[model samples]
Target chain A: MSTASPVLDELLDALRCLPGVGARSAQRMAYHLLERDRQGGGRLATALQAAMQRIGNCVECRSFSESERCALCAGSTRERSQLCVVETPADLAAIEHATGYRGLYFVLLGRLSPLDGLGPEELGLPLLQRRLAQGEVRELILATNPTVEGEATAHYLAELAQTAGVRVSRLAHGVPLGGELEYIDRGTLAHAFGSRLPLN
Target chain B: MSTASPVLDELLDALRCLPGVGARSAQRMAYHLLERDRQGGGRLATALQAAMQRIGNCVECRSFSESERCALCAGSTRERSQLCVVETPADLAAIEHATGYRGLYFVLLGRLSPLDGLGPEELGLPLLQRRLAQGEVRELILATNPTVEGEATAHYLAELAQTAGVRVSRLAHGVPLGGELEYIDRGTLAHAFGSRLPLN
Candidate 1:
């Protein structure tokens, strides 16, 4: 967007890169920044810089944190011996927010896809095996999503952990929270049916 | 977002604050930044700073610009005597992209809203008057939208310009280009009826 003004144009162009934002939104945000909150905008700008500077992946779980370990990793209550492995931090958050499990996490950062050339190495699975070999973990819970890649990744990881003399379990299959039965896809329903458990 | 790491948590929190982004999208963007584009993240942080440092309003038209005057303000070709007033820079861009008018612009930055205590003073009518009094203006175009506040603002500005001994014109009202009769709103259809033009 080449506006008559160069600097103003640059600012607008930069804002356009944000997810779902357009030229109009960028202009409105820029207008709000200039007219409404110079002090807040300055703080926000500073905060953005400081955050990017400080944030990095933790050595153990690959979760972002200011220090070498993340808060969850450092916490005493979280069970380190029972690792719940997932594909991303958002998945960790979703599981935590749901809150039935009381274990620590191992973020795979990605799923294995041979077609995409993202195998166990790409998913940091070799490191996971080494971490499991430390003889700390008892049960390895495969908590990945129910997609084809997720199922494939889970099976592959289960095989790896079994070879290392550890028990492997997956999060139970069922109707998801807030799921509409009518809207539920056929594959998920079939899985739920096949993996049905007795009522407690 | 209390990750063992404070930096990563803060970054995730900030990213989540962006409009319409859910936890999933936020984590994806965060991972993308961490794994692939740390330098780009750093550059975005700096870009935020640079935009704040450089962006200021155009004196003549009151839109954002790098210089004291915007590119449109400095342009020799834009008609100084023909000023088209609008509510914001977004409005200006919408009109520009629609691509008919060929004149200068004056951004009011807001609209008249009695409910919000946004009267003539709040809408920068005084600044507009100052522009009219500068004597280069031959015709002042009320190119504001035909919505309630837009109409009220246009009428108010037209009255002010008339009192200042300048001519006033309004954007024509009718069905929009590429609009279907069934889809046209009742108000627009009525306005078109009232202001029916002679057949060429």
Candidate 2:
């Protein structure tokens, strides 16, 4: 997109660093900012700079924070006996929003993948072990995703919890609430069938 | 996404100013930058600020430029007798890349949409008139899009060119090359049928 403008070219290239943006979308975004929304573009730039410079991981849960501890970890009212562990801050947000659970959270930031060089230390398991050793938590809920890596991370965390004398639980894997059994996948149907709960 | 972080909230809100980003994409982008690509995010911030503050319209052609006149308009080798008028700089770039046209360009930055408060003055018709009055251009090529507003703008520009005693031409509109007749839309097929060209 050599519009005979070097600044425009630089902007287009910079916009492609986003996750799903490609060449065409980058061009569109650049043109949009230059033509119609310079103010918004400036605001976005300020926000991006501030976030990148100031936001850091919480000392306790390792979630993004501007201070030493995140707001969630700093709050006094939330139950500390039940710790829900998730892979990312987004997952923590989902659990916080959807469920009534008032327990604290531990964000892994990523799953354990040796191939990608993500090990126990990368997931902050040592910090988690120290937190479990404090005896403040009685239950460690494995709220990781249902993927293979998520399950493996959960297994590892379960052993850590057992060593710390804490109970462990996992999120249920079954057909969705409103989904028909006919439309459910075979694996989910099998898992639900195998783990069917008795009616009272 | 009340991640219990005000900075994160601000970042998400600012990200939504982009064209296609929404709630979910904003969250995903924020988390991605904080977790995976802080350096890229910082670079993007710098690029955005620099482009927004420094990039301005070329006085000669109304295209984006860092200086008073764009490189294309300032070049001495291009044909001065043929001036192409386009709705946007992106259109100018598309013509530059896809064809052998070596004429200078006048970018409107927008078409004449009266409902949106766009008129002759807004499209820089006064500046264009002064250019045409110089009498150096022998032909004016109307390369605006084929939309309704585009056609109206082209008609207005054609009259302007005629008043200056310059020959006027437009980009041909019809079925695209290699387009099968069976799959082509009705309007394009009908237009192609009506404007059948005579073979040399």
Candidate 3:
């Protein structure tokens, strides 16, 4: 028989919806919320409610936004001729943090997964094609993950962009910065070797 | 220059208030809430709000409760003569889950830490003494953690229970069940050895 209070059990189960949280972590989170930081928990609740209600997919890029278009899509100063496609908003955020990629972005939200019934349509490929057919964008950068499904999605998108007369490029595959040769994965090392650039 | 939207940032920051949640985990949680399960996120928010607002300390045992007294404290079926003292409601719940110990519980909520300004008063030792002075409890179980502060607090509480003419007992310290001796900590190994039991 479960000994947990009904409300506590409900809260614990609800917390499991978060990524990477397990039963123990959920329990700890529930306790912390109830015992120590009720005010903070209340603030979290308010924030979650407000964010969920207000945030929606940006019309143009499919990234999360409170308005119809995200700030990146709405900004006039971004390079309209270049478009960067990413699998998720988190990936878009990472690129935006690291590089001066002033180009507009298209967030696929997820890659094609036939087993899971996710398809080109699910990834908004038709919309991407329409954007490419507009003939304003000169270059398309594929910044999706380097996994097998990400590769398939990238290839599919590349075909679509090339058909629409837009040049397509993929992010470089290499040993990560500050990584040792022995520690790097074999696939990454092989890719880095294959994509080796000439000396300046 | 953060590219995160305002509401997204707020949600991320709010998630950090959870125990063991760092900036990256909070960001991941925020993204999960915003991207995948807005409905579940809404549920979590509602649960947090409701639990925080409704749950308070049980007047008798100091365990979390939605009403004036916790179910354990309110239940007449429990052994009122045996009071088990625990550091937190989580610890109390753990004990309840593992054992058929039908005794009432007193949750300290925290251990005594002089360096952190936590003391007997902070742990409601006076209230505990008053409860002990009522003279109905035959045994006072010291189930505070096995840390240094936990031991000190146990000693302090043991003295209080002895002064009130109640017997004091502590949770056994030993190598945990299913634990390998090689992997056990020295303190635990030493305690296990020191408290070795004779075979019947």
Candidate 4:
């Protein structure tokens, strides 16, 4: 026998669509929405609907945007000669927030995962190729994550960029800033050692 | 420079109202909603609005319901002689799900927190007193959590029930089912030892 009302049960099930939100968390969220912040929940619903309706993939970079092109891609001052390719718009946002990279971006939206049937076409690689072929791009930076699929996607993109007569670069892999050596994984340590930069 | 659209940012901020949902999780949820399940997000929004509009406290139990009284309180088969007092509707639902407790319930919505200014009045103790005075309730079961505040609230309610000439009982506390003895806290272990029942 279900312990919650039908609407509450449907709300709980709907809340589980959020990443990392399991049954317990969904229940807590449902109860909170129902018992305390019904107004806030209503606002959230409106916001969700508005956002889903307004936001779409940027035509130029494929990142989420309210218009045909994202603000970053439409900016005239950003360097057109440098393009940073990331697996998701979230990664692009992280780099924009934390780094001084004043270049254009191309969000693949996902890595090439053969097991999941996600390939170049699925990631909109043809669009990326078209952008590179414009000859304005001098460098293509692979900013996909450090996972196996990310690495494979970056390698494939590098080959594509090289064939298009553009220089290719990968984000450096290293022990993170303020990371302890003892806690650093062996794979990262090895990559850091292998890719050690020279002091100029 | 904000990488997300204004609507997306609003949605992310709105999502943070959920308990334990931080900025990162909010971003992830927003992305998931936009990238994967726009329809599901819309459904959630509709459910949130509908639930907020329809669901309110049951007049008798104070638990969330669509009508004046909840289904449980409206049921004729339930034992009117036994009243179960719980801290929240979630707790009431838990008891209903885990056991064959057919008694009526009163939801406190919160425990007494003097520091937070949540006292007896905030938990609607007068309403509880009136219910106890109805003369139909013979036993009042305290199903509040085993926390300090929960215990204090339970004690306070027990005194009130005593004044009304109603018998009060507390739920048993022990090492949880499948919990290891070594991992159990000292307070729980002591309580378990003191309340040890005969194996007859």
Candidate 5:
């Protein structure tokens, strides 16, 4: 028990605001900052400021980007005809990392949650419609998560895209790789049943 | 696996860099990033950057600060005669939270890990010596951790401070709260026995 400083307290409090980080973690992080060399802290600080200063939502796909368009959107060679709808830029990134996806992306930014008052507007669906109307996008892939809200959003977007004369498809659902069928839920089971496989 | 992205891979790699967060946790965190809102990730990025940008080490106490002098160093009203030497700024914070002490602090940032090549110069012992040379500090309290490295560092600091004509004191060796004295190691027991209190 001794003299305490308020500046350090403020820094610790700011660190506390990080996700999944508790008071103890925040304190540890603060100590790490204090204990680490100026070079490390200085580099971290510079990275933070640089990201804040440069990164923003892409104008085209709403993905995080250093400019108005993200790297994917900025690239001219990638297919612009087929559009994959996802919940966030991270989802788009996830698909990109997995490879073989050659279509453009329409980042919805969020899913439909009527209870939470989040609707098509909150997800920027109007922009999606406008993009579809521009005649470049022919197919719309509903790549939302398999959760209830995600399913609902996918269904809604599929119907909307159908009316726009854009062929719609959903991500395939079944037992995940390295995952047992027993752990699969009833909804997935029902979908698997509807899309039954041929006997060997 | 229908939808995969390289961004997810990068994000996964980034997640692994965080302390105590490993591959499985990194996967969980990445899944969370895909599922959760910008509120969490955005805030983390901002906080990480802000802390790096604004926070720095205190010139006097060697704790993290956002200004030229930390709050403790800046405060003129606190006790300046006694000094509490700690392994890290978080230790100072923990002691401060427990309340009562009003002496100044001197953070070591790290303990003496000879195998890891950490030494007095790495811990800013010269600065501490200069401070003690001024003769304002009469009592030097060693509040280092109870680990072997911590004990060694405390002893080394104690010797140095004592050599500079200051009264050196080490923190008491005691059974931790909720820990059984019987379960404690033999070395700790011996130390606790040597520093035992009188029978009431």
Candidate 6:
């Protein structure tokens, strides 16, 4: 639909840049902001501008940060001997929220995807390698997702950790704690069965 | 999740002001923009700021416009004898897209809802009244939705049109074209049956 206002049209078009928003959703958002939440709209614009212009990767962990090092990297509470590698900052946040791990993190920002032109250099593996070569890290935990690309990235990182004389580990793959065996997918069930451990 | 960057956190919070977005969606949108589409994010910020700061309601139709009069109201191609009243600019766009109605329009921007504090004055009914009293509009078309509040607003508009000595009409209500009667809802089927017309 052709909006009577060119600015409204432009706003709608721009809103489609969001991840899941389409033309209809963009229209609703535009109308909603214009009708009820102009102040919120202005705030969003300011926030977006500030974030896009200022936010950059942390030099140490490669996670999003406004400064040279992220808070986790700059703080003294986290252990320097244990470093966890993850695909994105969101994954890093998930680990921090769900686990009691008090270690440093190295954010890959993306998994290994050759078709998309992301490689070791793009994932900042050289920086991670230099950190490992410094001999501060005694353990390297591979916490990338279980997808094909994630597995490949994890495999590559495992080799890197071994070459640097650091112990490497990966997240376990099995049925979830509350999952019923009957409902579990075949691949997971098979893997869990094959890798079943003896009772303690 | 607590983002490492304050600006990123602010951006995520401000994104929740949109109609259907929540925490997870906001996080995903922020990550996507930061990871793959910073340029698009910057463009959206610019567009949103311009729209929020500059756009205002057209004095004639009360639709969103940059200037005092909207293009539809200022143009001379449409017929002044017929005026179509709608509940929102989106509804007006739908009518313009679906039909060949080359007539003027009056956007209510909202319907009559006393509970929500929307009334005739809030809907700019006084401006509509003055336009009707000008003796230019011969036919008034009520194009509000079929909801309860929409029907109430349409009834109120019909009365105003009659007081101004203009012929009032409403869009026909019936089973939708190409809809199967067996699958239609009882309310619509019953209303269509009761308001059945002679074969044309």
What is the DockQ ranking, best to worst? 6, 2, 3, 4, 1, 5
Compose the digit string of candidate 5's lDDT tens values, residues A1-200: 22244544555565454457677776665566545543454444444344444556678887666566776788888898999999976677678878688988988877999898899998888889888788889899999999999999999998889778889999988766786678888877788779888999
Q: What is the TM-score of chain B in candidate 6?
A: 0.96
Residue B115 lDDT in candidate 2 = 99
Which consecutive 10 residues in model 5 chain B have the weakest lDDT in total? Answer: B1-10
Worst 10 residues of 4 chain B by lDDT: B1-10
When 1 and 4 are scored with TM-score, the better candidate is 4
For model 1, residues B93-119, the per-residue Cα lDDT tens digits are 777778666789988877888998889
Which regions of candidate 4 fall more than 4 Å away from where they truly are? B198-200
Please report, as a residue range, the 10-residue window in candidate 3 chain B with the lowest summed lDDT: B1-10
Per-prediction TM-score, please? 0.90, 0.96, 0.95, 0.92, 0.75, 0.96
Q: lDDT tens digits, residues A20-130, model 2?
A: 999888888888888889999999999999999999999999999999999888999899899999999999988888999999999999998999999999999999999
Model 2 achieves a DockQ score of: 0.79
**lDDT values of the candidates?**
0.78, 0.92, 0.90, 0.89, 0.74, 0.93
Better of 1 and 2 by TM-score: 2
Which of candidates 1 and 6 is the stronger one according to lDDT? 6
TM-score pick, better of 4 and 5:
4
Docking class of predicted structure 5? acceptable
> How accurate locally is residue A82 in candidate 1, as Cα lDDT from 0 to 100?
92
Using lDDT as the yardstick, the better of models 4 and 5 is: 4
Candidate 6 per-residue lDDT, tens place, B99-162, comes to: 9999999999999999999989999999999999999999999999999999999999999999
Which regions of candidate 5 deviate over 4 angstroms?
A: A1-7, A43-47, A133-135, A181-196, B1-60, B64-81, B114-117, B121-138, B160-167, B180-199
Clashing pairs in 1: A4-B71, A65-B5, A66-B5, A66-B6, A66-B7, A70-B4, A70-B5, A71-B3, A71-B4, A71-B5
Chain B TM-score, structure 2? 0.95
lDDT of 5 by residue, B1-200 (tens): 21233444455555444466676565555455434533445555556556656776778888777777787778887799989998887788888788688888998888999788888988889999999999999999999998889989988998998799999998777666687888998887787788789999
Where does candidate 2 stray beyond 4 Å?
A: A180-183
**Candidate 3 vs candidate 6, DockQ winner:** 6
